[model samples]
Target chain A: MARILVTDDSTFIRRRTCTILNRTGHEIIEATNGNHCLEIMQQDKPDLLFLDLVMPGLDGFGVLKTLQDAGNTIPVIVLTADIQDAVRDECMQLGAHTFLNKPPAEAAVLAALTDALAEGERKA
Target chain B: MTSAAHSSSTRQLNVLQKDAITELMNIGVGHAASTLHTLIGHKIELVVPEVSLITLDDYHQLQPYEADELLSTIWMGFRGGFEGNTSLIFPTDSANTLITALTGEMDDSPELDELRAGTLAEVGNILLNGVMGSIANMLNAALSYTVPEYMECSLLNIFRKNHTGNDTIMLARTTFAINELKVEGNILLFFKVASFEQLLISIDRELAI
Candidate 1:
């Protein structure tokens, strides 16, 4: 099982997402917002991240840009409730492994986890 | 009344200001829809078709509902580069429809009645924060939101509570819908007069960038 970090401002959303991922046997870490997520990343170095886009300080875009600039290669799966093709394209350009709508389905979550881990293994 | 007149005199938002507010709201609504998707397990869509600077009085004239119409309202306050109130307003039926769609259950249960208030608060909390957070980010400002409160009241009472003399509300007329469920609701953003001026300055700065 891979180490995954879930980041969002809402306590309810964070816990629900963690519960979903827990059933898949993955270890889950929680961050309240973007700044917290970044701090945790440095210490824990999780294999993948599930990030919320609209947060108080340092949104998901800010976090993604920072990671790219620092040459960090940890896979990021943007899980946001934001709309449009433009945002998806922008996240991919910034090196997000994939984008999924918030409250993703159990199957979709599992599939994304598999794909991200497989790709990480390939890179290694 | 004097403050309202004063605010009205300078209420016109320039092209740059309007665009900035529109873009910020567009980003915010998108995030709100994403949160809704998680609750319902279905993709949701919200669109802000118009962002206009209008005084509360002018808005009253254009409002679609009667003064006594029941509204499902969630209100919250935000402070950052500026301070203001944001709300999710829906006709009672629309709110019930949305709750039903999200929970996939009828509203007949007594438990459902209690859940209704909490459910709407959660929904509004996600949506309002999304909008304000986007606007703050675009302006490079830090915004913290108050805990959301849910209320069932007449449209007029809702407006009265939000209005304080001459507040220049940023009326971002929004349509939130889930195409699958055919449920739709409306949202509004209200920025107080002084808070709005600060926003305009921030928007101008963003435009310069």
Candidate 2:
């Protein structure tokens, strides 16, 4: 099972997402915001990251850019309430492996996790 | 600007502009409903039947809910190309009913205590994000939003706290039906004079394109 980091400012969303991932036997790590996410990444280095945009500070874009600049190839999946095409394009360009809307369905979440893990393995 | 001037400006929108705004709101509400259905595993129907722009002074005349009716409101402030506050407002009873239906909470309390308030806030966050995101996408406007806040208050009190006479409001009457439960609410967008003008410019740009 892969160890994953889920970052979002909303406690409810974090709990919901972690519950879903936990059910699948993946180890779950939580971060409250983007800055916290980066701090965790430096030490924990999870197998996958579920990032949320529109956070309070150093949002998803900032995290993605930081990882890209550091040459980190960890597979990143962006989950956000923002549905703008431009936002999706920016996420992908910043190296997000997958983009999913907020309140994502369980099946879609699982599918994205599987694909992201496989892609990560290939890169490794 | 004076209240009268603001009212005049709001009334200056041509029929086509008003229709376009209403249509955009309809699309946003539709998207929000789809997201809610996916989240709750329920059949959900959400529609924006009408949208009106009026100055805050006109608020009392156009008030949909009784002035003293208690409401569960989820409010989020947004800024970028334009600045405003948007809210999802439901009668307190309807809000409680919705939470109970979604969570299977057996609590019959009419008041949304802290725990339930969080749940409602998240739901509101998702719905408001859906509407705001869709509109922003269509307008090609980038916006930053404050985290959603949940409050229980009367409709008049809410207006008193958040608005001034110089502001303009775009009020959308929204209907929500989940399974057999039917709940009606209002999606209110409050903007200052400058922001309202900025919004009109953006809308005009969208129309021109």
Candidate 3:
């Protein structure tokens, strides 16, 4: 089980994602927006992050750009309703590992978690 | 600018520009329907969205219902790659039906209790965010949204509260359905004349029209 951070301004989405991850025996930390997301990462690094793109403060794109500039390699799985191809491509270019639509399928979340955590282990 | 001038300017949009705007609104509505389905674990079917562009005065003329009809509204302001005020307006009855469907609680009064109001705001957040996000993605612009606020007021008051000069309203009416239950609501996005001009320029560049 990996330690994961979930960031989203929507309480429902955050709680739902946390519930799904908890079922997999993973430790979950939640943040409401991009600024909070960065704050959490600085204090304690998680194995993976589930980030939402549209947020009140700094959005997911801002977070990704900041991480890339800081040379942080944390694998971020973007969770968002914005599924446009352009968005997907941009996130990937910004170093996102995978993209999942909001209210993600449990199986897909687990699969992504496995892939991201495995990558983290390999790098460590 | 005067309301008359604003109305004429909005009416001057060529067929192509109008069609493009409608297509963008449809994409946004599609995103909202999918998100709603995910949240409720219910299959949601969104009827084809109808987009209307009108001045606030024109909007007033279009309201045929009683002036005092109460509405459940979730309002938010957005800025960044695009700037606008967005509100999800549901008739009292429709709002009650939706809250009941989501929470399994029935309330006769149209006014949302605190718990129900919170749920409604969250729902509005997801729906509006999806809509605005789709538009932003197409424009390749980043957007920042204000926290959504829930209010119960008459339809006339709702408009009065959001009134501003040099505003063009884009109203998208769509029917949301989960089996037998149907909720029809309007996702109203109000853009300042200047901001809307920026939107048009961005669209032209993005679509290379």
Predictions ranked by TM-score, top down? 2, 3, 1
Of the two candidates 1 and 2, the one with more favorable TM-score, higher being better, is 2
Q: How well is candidate 1 docked (DockQ)?
A: 0.09
Model 3 chain A: weakest 10-residue lDDT segment is A80-89
Interface DockQ per candidate:
0.09, 0.57, 0.28
Model 1's number of clashes is 2
Cα lDDT tens digits, model 1, A76-112, are 9898644345567779999999888655667877888
What are the models' TM-scores? 0.63, 0.86, 0.76
Evaluation by lDDT, superior candidate among 1 and 2 = 2
Candidate 3, A8-114: lDDT as tens digits: 87766676688889988878999999999999999978888999987777999999999999987789999976655667888999999999876678999989989
Candidate 3 off by > 4 Å:
A34-36, A42-44, A56-66, A84-90, B1-11, B41-48, B61-68, B79-82, B96-118, B136-144, B157-162, B166-179, B200-209
**Per-candidate clash tally:** 2, 0, 0
Which residue runs does candidate 2 get wrong by more than 4 Å? B1-11, B45-48, B61-64, B107-115
Candidate 2 per-residue lDDT over residues B90-150, each given as its tens digit: 8886788777766677676755365588778878888988888888898988877887889
Model 2 interface CAPRI class:
medium
User: In terms of lDDT, which candidate is strongest?
Assistant: 2
